[model samples]
Target: MIILKYIFKFYIPCILLITAVTVVLCVRKPYKKQTVNRVVFNERYFRKISGTEKEKYLDSIVTSLNDERNDSVSRDLYLKAGEEYYYLNNIRKSFTSSQIALNLSREAKDSSRIAKSLYFIGDCYENSQKDSAYYYYLQAQKIYTLINDYEKLGRMHFNKAYVLFYDGNFVECEIELTKGLNYLKNSDNEKLLYSCNTLMGNCLEKLFMYEQALKYHQYALGNLKEMKKNNLDSDEVNNFNVSSVINICNLYDLKGEYSKSIKELNAVLTKDLKKKWPRLYANVLSNLAYSKMKNKEYKNVEFMFLESLRIVDSLDYRSDAIYKKIYLGEFYLAQKDTLMSLKTLKEAYRSAVEMKNTNEILRTLRLLTKIDNRKKVFYANRYIDMIDSINSIRSKISNKYARIEYETITVEDENKILTKKNFYILIFSFAAFLILLSIFGFVYLKYKNKELKFVKQQQNDSDEIYQLLSEQNEIINKAKEEEKNKIARELHDGVMNKLYGVRMNLGFFNTKLDDKSIEKRKEYILELQNIENEIRTISHDLSRDSFLEGSDFNTLLSNLIANQKGLSRARFKYIIEENFDWEQVQNIYKINVYRIIQEAVLNIHKYSRALNAEVKIQLSEDKILKLSILDDGIGFDINTVKKGIGLSNIKERANSLKGNLDILSGIGKGTEIIVMFDITR
Candidate 1:
């Protein structure tokens, strides 16, 4: 199936080109429009213009392009403007101009320009600006499909793979990357092929498909070799060669072939490419050092790691430098150099924490655990804490994906019902045609039969639609119960375990307290007590009993506000009207409301830069809960700001609860969120 897809993808462009030729041959007069003078200026002029001058230049171009008298010229101008803005990293402006270009191209029915604009839009979205990156990539994918532009289609799929990865959907990412490779299989575009294979290998590795990943990396290497053979000495080709080599080395390291890995790294180094590519060199050195460390060549590993560290430090790049430090610490730990290992591992651990490298931190913590018995307890506790936190996050991501799938299936079922209904309508029309032919044989009899058939068909259609709706509702109910269980498990297994362990640790220390040591023990006890308090705060609100009883709504809100008050400097103003009938609320609806408010308040406190905020919950007479959350802050335009997981969570939860949520905010204006949901007794 996959090979067939590749073949079809390759042939689609040729078919499209033939169709284009046929259209052009059949058509007589082609419309001609005036070319815009604005298209003559390049990105260099925009770069030369400073501050307000640059803004003025852009503004004049936009105004001139907006002139209704110059539609074709306007489109060309917009495309040029978009290119300039894209170069400047002004993604918002670039996206706007590209969208304008797309609109114009669509209006003109120009397939080539439409494809080009879509490609630019995809590029803009894939860059730093985050809003609807996936959406834009998907849009570009559809446009490329229409134009049968396989190269752009492959690029779009690759970008979608990245989005899936960031969303923690590694399985989906690997699948999408495979689709990308299939789309580009027969293409002569060596750069695109290399990129697709490398990314596929990376995602496969992340998914723990080591053998498959190595195969893809090797495939990429083969392409690079072919490109070289073709006499294309592009820097891009060189970069791909180096990357494929590194991926191959890493795969070997994972496979426990440390010796072979070192050989691959050495080969890259022998190419004299180290000086020209410091980052890659540093990474290669770090990997080679790790391989040596595993092979028990302590002295050699030390020197190699130090070189990598020095290079990374000089280049001011800490990503690989942190890895080198951790490896060096591991080497010292293995040698039983306790003092040096402790100091080195501690620094490495700090760097890992600062860099947010969970894997490195986990490794360093394990090293710390194997050191002196005195600090072994602390290190062991930290290791367990990190593991639990990771597990909790994994569980959360799984639950989110599961919910997304459930909702998707529900939509499919609903669409199926609509399709079935249309089918029945078509059948009814065919029956009417038969009746018209048989009208002479039986006039009133034919009419009676037709009416009966129509009535029966309507009943069947209604039954099917009703059945689908019921099934959808059942799926949603099951998902809610599962989600509730997952949340409970996270609370009990994660936060509760840490709190218990810390308290137990403090209890053990309490027995050995001397006069001076008593203060230190008490300090540790205080820290543990604070952690316990936080757990209790979260537990009290997240409790299954209160949620099931539906009496915990007010308590949950109060706890959140109190927690925020304790954690932040901003004053929190929370208001709940007396009309709130907690006892009558449904558990799922209550939980959804609580989570939405929790996410919203956290975002406001963390990112709003607000001094004050207000939250209001009111039970309306229509058996609905109306929540109005407001914040007086340096707000953002919802239309422009990219919605992340937290905001997505709020929206998703609201959808799951069959509620409506509207967000109103602009630059300097405060944010006001209104959520309304029916909650019947």
Candidate 2:
């Protein structure tokens, strides 16, 4: 055993060293191989390839990437591969790469990358799984909006609109396309603008607005021309131009301008549309043949129709093929071949039914009924069933689309909540805490500034009211001083002289000491009593104009009611709480309260036509001031009688005082304006 241990101890270190070296070489060998082929595997060189080769190379690159990485580079690499795969018509692989990218972007919390990843995933599902594609596009749209990426957001809108168009919801498709254009208005992306315009033109054509459709198609061609100046892909620009031309020609055909349609189609066909876009080329040919057939020029029309059908069938475009068959059936009917027309219409009807295209099926059934009279009842019933099913299908599609949007919005809300929570947690970090502190300080300052502004405005209003009242008080004071001087003169010139004369008469009576003198003294005493009565009358006159030394409202409010009584025949009365001190009220509160009472009294005088009016003011123990202005006049219906400026001013003053006002009135019921305020607050 010792011999075996010694041998292990000596050779184990050598074995361990050699094994570690071997493992290191094995681990790095793939990396070295990657370096040698970096020109091919590298993302930096990805732009060097195209078509099927590029898609295959992207798949290989994705397979070779380290699965453990969750970084921006890896995320971007996966996103690029996914987009390339989608362009190459490999949606399954595209979806896989986009999903990985999405996961990595989420882990990294990268909003822009996440949006781009979701957009690619949406693109992958756009052709087959429209609802899913719409949902993903909506999610991406939300992210783009949050990040303020208008270009991508506009693209998402158009993609979603295309999905709606595919479902035959032309109205909604037009609406979304319009919104997409608004977002792309400021974008320099001419290609996407061209796409949006072309789709918009198609929508208008479907709605049968031929003239407006032509205008949009013209706009689309204009976009294509601008795109060409930008050095956009020649093939892409050609495709867009062809699409616009075809749409314009279709509109012309709808307008019964078949020669115009044929001319446009022939013009676009010269751009080698067949080699570039086979489906659009077939579409152009089909429209050209239809236009020729409609214009009564049947030269090579059947051959062109057959050629278009051959391309569509080879491409397995079932909807296009169905439409072509229906057109051919119409041609046969024009030729008076009723048997062939009925057979063709029947075949088109079956194809449309298999495709679940309700409108086309109804149209084909209608055509079949016209030709095959023996089966008219059958076709009619089938047509009604299809019409009913169409409503159901539209309802189902609407619900499905709405549900998808709802789910996307719900998930976005949840993600926002989670992101906010993460942000809150991040606030605990030192730098974040500092940032938060600065933000708090700024917010606090803003709030304080607003409060200060409000307070300053209130102060200005109070000053204006105070200045006004001061002017009123000056007038009152001047009148009071003049009245006081007049009363002083009356006392001095009238009462004092009479009293002096009475005293002199009394003295003269004292001088006489006989019977005649006694009669004179009685006369003199009677004259003195007359002088006393005159003095008392002058004192009463003085008291009417001036307030008492300690009294305030015995004159101010009473004087208000008294003056209003002169304007209206209404007998005015007022009440003030015994404990309330007018001097202790804040100016803002005091002036508003004064103005409110003034306004209410004026309103009653002018409008109420009441025989009696009362102003009651009370202050509770907790400093709550309650005021009521009541009138017993022919009352108005509050709802019927709109509040005039007087009532509005009263309410505004009450609000300025931070008080609640309730005006209760009904026909034949006296109006009562009740106001309450917490003065201490």
Candidate 3:
């Protein structure tokens, strides 16, 4: 029994110890195998390689690092691979590598590396997916700013501005360029300084601020010239000089100095430069042609345009090619070759529609309208619709720019205050360390409180803006409803009554006709019946909301008058200025203008007992919409008569639209209402 007890105690303990040791050793064996299989890469050797060799070296490093369990080293290797792929112009691969690196960096909680990876991803998508690129760039900018990497943050802003510029968001691009310039002002990075100025010039040019654009372009040119004189003869420097010269030429063109622009472009058309920079060369040629066309140098204009077209075609520069085609069409139109103009413009229009090029589409539509009166209304309506879309996009871009600018300024102010406090704490630390700590603690608490207040104020501002937009939308909806009600009343009262009168006249004719005269009377009765049918059709069209859905204010006014003709005894005459692009006006402004006119006409129909009324919509040279409604009706005294609901609604809508309204009325005289609103605002 004693031997059995010893066996149980000693043998059981030894067996349990053996099992635990064996289990641990088995786990350690796999770990050792993993260590043996893992490969180490030499980054220095990869850096030493060049060209294809360097790319291959990077690939090797990536392959080796993929199996490594160390996230930091793997992320660094992926970043290197991404850079190599970017240099090779393998954008998809570059994006994939950067995405992997971004994931790793996020897992590691390394904000700086994550920012870098995001920037790389942005670069990869810069040309293909601009909105995505802009988003990534903004993400990187926020992180870089938070980490106090001003240089990278400045670059990020510039990159974002580039995407905005390409997307035709000039106002936002201008804002970003301004921010980048501020960040890089004290920096010694001459390359970035030149890029910022160049982009700023381009944005200003697009915004039609010609003088500012010229100044910036000239400044950039001067910088490049100085650099050239200082023996900076690199390809990048040369490219900058060429680009700056092109910008100056474009500015001159915009400023109406056609001769000077032509001269500048001519000087840029050197054979060597053209060979080295085909795209720039083509653009210069195209601009030279346009300048020549403006200067009325008609002989060589076509030749220059054709040459630019050929160059761009060979280079597969789709946007440039499209621009050249449009220019060619315009040239044909100016030369009075209607056949050729229509042909080229039609082709260009189709291409522009396919490309969704808003500018080109509007230009082509305008030219086509001038050539073909048959399709004038159709093309004009399309052009106006596109203009509204472009304006909306610009408005959104402007709002975004304002928000980004506000946020950037707020953050910068906070950073400056924090930096100042830190400087003070360091300065006081040696003299009184405890006092420094107390001061820092107090400053920190104060900063936190101020930050909270600032955040609250920002939230309040945002809410106010949202409320204002909501109110505008509500006003627009109410105006549309008022318009619909007025149309319904007109259709029911005027058109139906007119049709009933026609039917009664026809019935009387049928009763009065004898058998011998029946054939002649039947002809007259048939004419009366046709008139009734026409009125019914007109009433049906007016009843549908889609008939009044035209974006052009003038077109909508025309439709309104047509519907009113059968309903009202008063003759409505409308005069709209020809040169105005009514599409440039905001939808809310258009709706308000439309409702005001509609209400005034209804009021005249109800009580004016007028014979004639005139409605005029004109756009002034200063970008203001001027509206006038006059009726030769028995007018009431302004001081004695209380305003009705119609008049009150008109006045309220005008006020909400930021317009000035003037009412002139006197007893036994006509009534006239004039409204003026600034469209530019």
Q: How would you encode candidate 1's per-residue C-alpha lDDT over 615-671 as one tens digit per residue?
A: 888876558788888898888988679998667777777776678889999998978
Ranking by lDDT: 2, 3, 1
Which 10 residues in a row give candidate 2 its minimum summed lDDT?
31-40
Candidate 3 least-lDDT 10 residues: 428-437
Error of 1 at 35 (Å): 8.1
Model 3 TM-score on a 0 to 1 scale? 0.54
* Runs in model 3 lying further than 4 Å from the true structure: 1-58, 68-76, 106-111, 127-131, 226-233, 391-681
- Local distance difference test values of all predictions, in order: 0.74, 0.78, 0.77
- lDDT, model 2, position 20: 59
- Considering only N, C-alpha and C atoms within 3 Å, which residue pairs clash in candidate 3? none
